[model samples]
Target: MFLPAVVLGALVLACLVSLGTGAADLGLADLFSGSDDSSRILLVSRVPRTLAAVLAGSGVAVAGSVMQMSMHNRFVSPTTAGTSQFALVGLLAVALLAPATSVMGKMLVASACAVAGSGLLLRLLHLLPARRTPADVTVPLIGLMLGGVVEAGTTFVAWRYDLLQSLGSWTAGDLSRVLAGRYELLWVVAALALALYLAADHLTVAGLGEDAATGLGLSYRLVVDLAVAAAVMTAVSVVVVGTLPFLGLVVPNAASRICGDNLRRALPVVAAGGALLTVVCDVVGRLVHYPYEISVTVIMGVVGAGAFIVIILRGVDRA
Candidate 1:
């Protein structure tokens, strides 16, 4: 109760700050006073952008948590674990092969690629020896290496086709252009969040490894469902707001540290904490350049890298 309250409060505060921090000269007071068309800005831009951040951030965080649990590794996420890279691949593919595709069409394609990527990762994981030593980075290292290879390939192809600029826009998260009609895909993300919450118990059991889960009468199929959910979560967020690097990775880790590994207990905090972190990053991005605006990806990369280092050191020390 206390933790959820704190996270939700922080989220609300961050959202308010986010709503008021953008360009076009809108303030919180202006929202109510309807000064300078601030109310219009609030509806058309600020509100949509903030909501997108919250939904995408929370969705990706939950996906990352599920990814970690299913794979029995704490270091992997949609960003670090090849999910977003494959999503990028799908987006680029759709752009190239089917330029006439709708937003939902692009999402479906990216999601399919993401799901295939996760499947490949699962198959690869089976070939590795199990260990949890302090130096054990087998899972994340492999996932990173996989994502790097795919990302490089995608980059090369995009470069060859002169789609690098377009690719960059798709990969770097920018909410400045997120207007009202552009962000409704996040409602689907909200639904995914609900699915994760409802299935939290099964996710918990499945996290104990397939053999354990099967012995405990948990259907192994839940692992597949978890993978699909994580993949879709990553894809939708990417399709809508671009890839928010290290967001999903670090947010779940923070939630686990605060509330232990239980999904039921940790999911709420993960959602709110992710939303807060993202909105705060967006605010930082907006403030750092003033009227020019920095991308959320830039701010997230800087902050998430620092947090990643801290997490690594802490995990090694504790192990």
Candidate 2:
């Protein structure tokens, strides 16, 4: 609780910083009151991008935490594996199939499809011989293979239709173009995060292992479904805002190290940690090249992957 509060406080601070420091260089005063252009850019552009980072960060981090718990492994997440790619495939499919659809409608379709794809993979895992190894590692491996297959299809289609540039733009993490009306759709993901928060206890119990959760009279499959739902929400949010790399896998593990793996207790902490990391990364992205900003995806892919490697090595050494 203390950890989460502190982290969330830091998250708020990071958000304020992100809102204030940007290409336009607005002070705290300007954030509150300024010219119409300043207000529009601050309220419409900066606010939405900040919100997107926070919401997307929270969503991915919580999903990764639940996924790690559910599978009893730390190596799994949409970003680590290929689940995010599959979700991207879903988003591209929607774009190709329904060009007239609203962004919210596209997000819904992509999210549902991603969840279904993940569900299919889960079912297939259940039907397998049930290896004793942690599901996190194995599930991500499977997801990677599945994502490769899906990406191939997406690549072929995009090339065939000359939509590769547009598809590429969507896959890269860039919040520079975020606007008021367009960004509101991500609040649906916020709602989904709230649901996961409410069900945290059940999820933690289920993460103990299927047999234990079953012994406790919780429906194991239902809890698994909920976790998948959370993952889909995370993936869809990423798809909506382009890909964010390390927030999911890194934040939750950090939270658990501080908060003792109690899902109800850790969820908020993980969310805060995620948001903090994302905002910091965004700030760094803006500062790294001045007017030419780098994407958070690249920053995380480089730094976050290094951090992940260190953590994994530490775990291996402890074992």
lDDT of candidate 1 over 203-251, digit per residue (tens): 9888776688899988887555766888998999999999998988899
Q: lDDT score of model 2?
A: 0.76
Q: Stretches of candidate 2 above 4 Å error?
A: 127-136, 316-319
TM-score of each prediction: 0.96, 0.92
Which candidate achieves the best TM-score against the true structure? Answer: 1
- Predicted candidate 2 versus true structure: per-residue lDDT over 75-182, tens digit per residue: 667765566777777777777888788777777777777777667667756765654454235666776677778788888888898889877877787877677776
lDDT of 2 at 270: 82
Relative to the true structure, candidate 2 reaches a TM of 0.92
